[model samples]
Target: MSKHIVPLEYETGLAELRGDCARMAPHWVVPAKAAASPVAASLIHGVTVPPASARLIDAMSDYGD
Candidate 1:
């Protein structure tokens, strides 16, 4: 199966991280349930304005259970 990533920023971040910033960060690593929740999308929660170090990995993709 092919994997599609919705890198945690506006469209701009997709371009940024895909480039040399391979190790860049998303605003947050969301739980699959929360991330996929239609209600949550409307809310658009964040982990504060800016994290000290925003680098995080979500290799697991969807965090189920």
Candidate 2:
């Protein structure tokens, strides 16, 4: 006689979650901010923000309290 082992439904769900975690693994590592110094210098000099950058800042501002 031969026996078969079957995984439960939750096991499949867990496997899918594992795959998602793997795909997002790189996002877990913060990338270096290479342009930070230039941005900071511009801010210190009171340089005007471009319209696109200003819009991005406005959009991102709504993401938090």
Candidate 3:
């Protein structure tokens, strides 16, 4: 998947978390009916943000230094 370019806040957090952030993953939950509902279909959904990358991690590490 392509890397997401999130806001600096997320980038900073991800950088601070470092390796621990590896466990993070995109997640979503919706009832079967909701998933199939016209409203749900019409509504904009899904994670558009990209995950953090090595560059982001390194940059975050330098935050307080």
lDDT of each: 0.53, 0.75, 0.57
**Estimated TM-score for each candidate:** 0.16, 0.26, 0.16
Give, for candidate 2, the lowest lDDT window spanning 10 residues. Answer: 34-43
Clashes of 2: 0
**In model 3, which runs have C-alpha deviations exceeding 4 angstroms?**
1-16, 24-34, 39-65
Q: Which digits, one per residue and each the tens of the lDDT, describe model 1 over residues 1-65?
A: 99999767556666765764556446447566645535656587765633333323233345422
Better of 1 and 2 by TM-score: 2
Candidates in order: C-alpha RMSD to true structure: 20.7, 11.8, 22.0
Best by lDDT: 2
TM-score of 1: 0.16
Which ten residues in a row are the worst by lDDT in model 3?
Answer: 22-31
Model 2: per-residue lDDT, tens digit, 1-65? 99999966554577898999999998897879776443455457656889998777778857523
Q: Write the per-residue lDDT of candidate 3 for residues 1-65, one digit (tens) a residue.
A: 89989866455565667646555533334447645435665577784544566456656857524
Model 1 residue runs over 4 Å out of place are: 1-38, 58-65
